[model samples]
Target: MSAQSLRHQLLTADKPGRADLLFGYLRAHGNKHYEEEGTQMQHALQCAALATRGRESATLVAAALFHDIGHMLADDPVEANNPTLKDDLHEELGANYLKGIFPEAVLQPIQLHVAAKRYLCTLKPAYYEQLSEASQKSFRLQGGPMSEQEIAAFEQHPFHKAAVKLRGWDDQAKDVNVEHLEIDAFRASVLEALS
Candidate 1:
């Protein structure tokens, strides 16, 4: 389906229909390469697997699976990955797109996951060194690291901890060698998250 059709489905479909449309969309577009080593589908599945292994709530697991969806939703997903472009703000775009379909438990973490990266960079200088080269470049595009005030505010958010955890999984999810569950494995969680 075209992006317009998908958006229409998301806007008008029932919960199950919305989930179906989203999964279909992912199946269609998720094979594209991400900024890192794995395909976008691989990253998403890896992140969701990590969340499930960590025994996160269903909502959080669903959030992990779809956190980078804005990259797909971008006018040009390939270009969105370019660090030289202004930060795509994929986190906010994804969260906003999912707002009505998912509860805050899912949306908040997706929204804050990028900020969580900046927060971690501030909290642990060593963390910056650990990022993949592509992530490090995008980090600069994403405002380098957070300030003390930004950290303070991030800490105060209700979902900060979840976002931090999600960020950790995001950092780890790029391994090309790691095996991951298929997108269908997340169907239950996705359906459950839909409102």
Candidate 2:
């Protein structure tokens, strides 16, 4: 199906049908990966799976699944193919697009997940060393670790904790060989969170 058609389906379809369309979109457009070990779809599935396994809220699981979708939706060549390129701010782009469709529970985490990475680096002295090569590269483009003031301010956001947890799962989601729950598994959760 065309990207436009799939997007339309995602916006207007029923829960189960939306799941199928989302899965189709992921399978088609999620093949590109600049830094991570797996395809974008794999990483998304893994992140959502982690959230599901942890028994996080349905909105959180949906947030985890859709966090990086901005990367796929961006028209700029640099967005998906080169994280080392200008910090495309895909998080903001994705979050903005989703805001009209999902509740704050789902949208807020996507907006902050990138900052969560920066915050994690500040909170854990050795966190920078644990990042994958691509993440390490993107870190510089993404403003590196947060400053003390930045951390202090970031902590004030209501979704800060959830974003941090999502960031952790995002980091862990790059394992190419890991088993993952199917995208359709979250139909109920995603549907519930859809605005």
Candidate 3:
């Protein structure tokens, strides 16, 4: 199917259909390895599973699932191997692409997830130390943590806490061996959050 048609379908699809399209997309493009993790799809599933296990709202769980989808849009060979090789700003890209399909509750976390990473680096001195090597590299490209002023501004956003939580999930989602729900498992939650 064409890109336009897929977008329209994703935006207009019922819960199950939308989930299918998302799954198809991930199955096709999500094959790319994400740093040390197995693949992009694996990471997404792990993130969503983490949110589910944490008993987060559907919006946050969906946000966790789609957070890095922007990366799927690009076929950057170097980036697939070296995260710091490129900064595609996947957060903004994914949020913009998903805006028409989901509500602010879902979109905001995807948009701010990167900022959440930067914010965490600022709030916890040891936080930066815990990041994976690929994460550490991307952290530099993402502005190498936030300044105090930036941190204050980030914390003031309505979804600030949620985004931070999502970021934590994002970081932990890299474990390849973790058993988690697949994309289709979020069908009900995705349907509810659709705009």
Candidate 4:
């Protein structure tokens, strides 16, 4: 199936588990990657789970889960370095692709994951120092260190805090083992909650 079709299906998948989409992405597109210490898929799922556990809203959790769906859609592998000579702004790419499919509730956080990372660096003393060299480079490529106006604007977004927490998890998710719930429509209540 084409990547475009797959994303359409995934957006409307009868049973859309963050883990399922992520695992699918890993099996299909993930090349050896580095974002601190984990694979790209690992980073997204961890971010979602971390947000959920922190009592973040369902929109935030959904954003965490689907944030990197763009990586799967990118023209080439984007982990170690750009797979293509052209730009592979996975964060923006992911958010743009997702906005067409998911509600803005979901799209907003997905879009902000990168910003969340940058924002975290400014706030979390050890954050930048702990990033892998590749991620450090990627951060600059992704637009490092939000300017005062940019940071202020970014911070005001509704789900900003959860986005930051998810990014922190994104950075750390790959460094460890990942466990996940199997894909099934979340309990009706869970689905309703997210919807």
Best by TM-score: 1
Score candidate 3 by TM-score against the native.
0.89
Best by lDDT: 1
- Candidate 3 per-residue lDDT over residues 1-195, each given as its tens digit: 654356667867876788778778778788888676579888888998999889999899889888888888546442234333244578887787676788999999999998998898878868889999999899899998688899889989999999999999998988877776767788777777777
Error at 190, model 1, angstroms: 1.0
Q: What digit string (tens of lDDT, one per residue) describes model 2 on residues 1-195?
A: 545444445668766676666666666678888677688988999999999989999999999999988888685343334333334578987787665568898899999999999998878868878989899888889998788899989999999999999999999899988887777787888887777
Off by over 4 Å in 1: 75-87
Clashing pairs in 2: none
Task: Report the candidate with higher TM-score, 1 versus 3.
Answer: 1
Between prediction 1 and prediction 2, the one with superior lDDT is: 1
Alpha-carbon TM-score of each model against the true structure: 0.91, 0.86, 0.89, 0.70
List, in order, the clash count of every candidate structure: 0, 0, 0, 1
lDDT for each residue of candidate 1 in 69-177, tens digit (9 for 90 to 100): 8887774554344343354578987787776789999999999999999999988989999999999999899998787899899999999999999999999999999
lDDT of 3: 0.81
TM-score of 1: 0.91
**Clashes in model 1: which pairs?**
none
What candidate 2 gets wrong by more than 4 Å, as runs, is 1-18, 75-87
